[model samples]
Target: MIDVVAAILKQGDKILIARRKEGKSLGGYWEFPGGKIEEGESPEKSLIRELKEEMMIDIKVTEPFGENIHDYGDKKIRLIAFWGEIDSGEIVLKDHDCIEWVFPKDLHQYNFSPADVSFVEQLMK
Candidate 1:
């Protein structure tokens, strides 16, 4: 199974969400910004690294928010999510096609990745 980490990055009352680039896996689906956890790295460390590498932003990972295991026909992933806040740097789009800051109640408007749906549900509640 692929091990992944995601950040519920917050700015005031809004949370950050990124859309996968077209032609990529889960293309056009929105997700919490993060990537696969490298070997030997803790989930929090992985999230910090991923946010930097993908979005060019440093984050302070706070508490664990939730986790889920999902199968997408050929691939299965264990996705771990954490509450986080951006600590520094401007946001840059390297891996994603677009990004948005949205209120939790408005998250339902975007089509999110299946693995990320659980986190969205938790946030909306």
Candidate 2:
């Protein structure tokens, strides 16, 4: 299984969501900004590194909201989703095609990776 971490970052009533770049895996899908967890690294550390690499922002990871295991055709992904807050830096689309701060009700408008769909459901609840 591929271990990954995702940041559930919110600013008031809106949550941050990033659009994956075309030609990438799950291209055009929207997801919480995060990346693979390296060996010997904790989920929090992975989240911090991923946010910085993908979003160009630093964040402080809080408690995990939930975890989900999803299987795509080629691989299985084990996602550890955590709630986090921005510590510093600007929001730049370093890896994603675009970024949006969307309200929970509007989340369904975008296409999301199957694994990430569960996280969004948790956010709504």
Per-residue lDDT of 10-119 in model 2, one digit per residue for the tens? 88889899999888887899999899999999999999998988878899887888899998979999999998889999998866898899999889888888999988
Candidate 2 residue pairs in clash (backbone atoms < 3 Å):
none
Candidate 2 TM-score, true structure as reference: 0.95
Error of 2 at 26 (Å): 1.0
When summed lDDT is taken over every stretch of 10 residues in candidate 1, the lowest stretch is: 20-29
User: What are the lDDT figures for the candidates, one per model?
Assistant: 0.95, 0.89
Off by over 4 Å in 2: none
Give the per-residue lDDT of model 1 (tens digit) for 1-125: 99999999989999999999998888999999999999999999999999999989999998999899999989999999999999999999987999999999999999999999988998999
**Best model per lDDT:** 1
> By summed lDDT, which 10 consecutive residues of candidate 2 come out lowest?
116-125
